[model samples]
Target: MRRLALPLAACLLLAGCAPTVSLTPAPQATAVGCASLIVGIRGIETIGDAQRRQTDAQGTAAWGTPASVTLYCGVETPEASALPCTTQSGVDWLLSESGDERIATTYGRAPGVQLITTRDASVNDALETLSGAVATSTRGTDRRCLADPGASATPSAIP
Candidate 1:
């Protein structure tokens, strides 16, 4: 019994000296909205390789960033709106960004000519910070058009 008590005491002392470890949880993800534009200019073939340079220059001057020139998703037809994505020079462009990862494209169309409409951090973020505000279906409503936010223009009018 005496020997057992000494060993137990030593074990207890050793156990008390052992360090306790802990871990901290990482932060949650964030979201955002950023502008993106897709335009298909006519006479593109005639422009030839110059189209590449011209598109790049135009995008840099307009978006002040590396614009990815690609195909047009617009279905051009007289049946379309007056300033449809096909006819208009630009559209309301926005994409979402969460920390290092790009969340997704917020607004369907481009963000229009003016990249930064407001000095708001989201606008300046270049990469947007989004939330449940996006990722939802949006009907053709001028109310939510960042290109011309709340303009007194009609659906057929390009504000």
Candidate 2:
């Protein structure tokens, strides 16, 4: 009877320590996935983890193309705790997307990215406008970018 109680307690203890999400496999985000283009991120200004270089490049490549992309980066240090480790811990953390950010504010990663690949003749001349819109919406304080998180995903009028 006592042994059974101990095991149950241990199980409960471990469960409490773990986040609702999985922590294994090191989350190799080859790209940040976001459906809506209006409210999601477009491109990352910079990333923290060097390992994500491939993924980052893949995201950047989507520019003016027909693909949406997201990139995340952060410091996952050994000598400290998780995201609570502060923004300037000088360590690499796990970066993810703003897709979940809209729902939960705690799903913080190092620096997650979100982008949409849609058709728009404006993509050629108004690249900054699009990129800025997404960025300001997700990470910035601008709501114009947040108006329709999935708006840019509309089919390209180019054809």
Q: Pick the candidate with the highest lDDT.
A: 2
RMSD of each: 22.0, 18.0
- For residue 132, give model 1's deviation from the true position in Å: 30
Location of the lowest summed lDDT over 10 successive residues in candidate 2: 84-93
Model 1 misplaced regions, further than 4 Å: 1-40, 46-68, 72-90, 95-140, 143-159
Worst 10 residues of 1 by lDDT: 26-35
Candidate 2, which segments miss by more than 4 Å at Cα?
A: 1-123, 140-159
lDDT by residue for model 1 over 100-134, one digit each (tens)?
32211223322212222111122323222111112
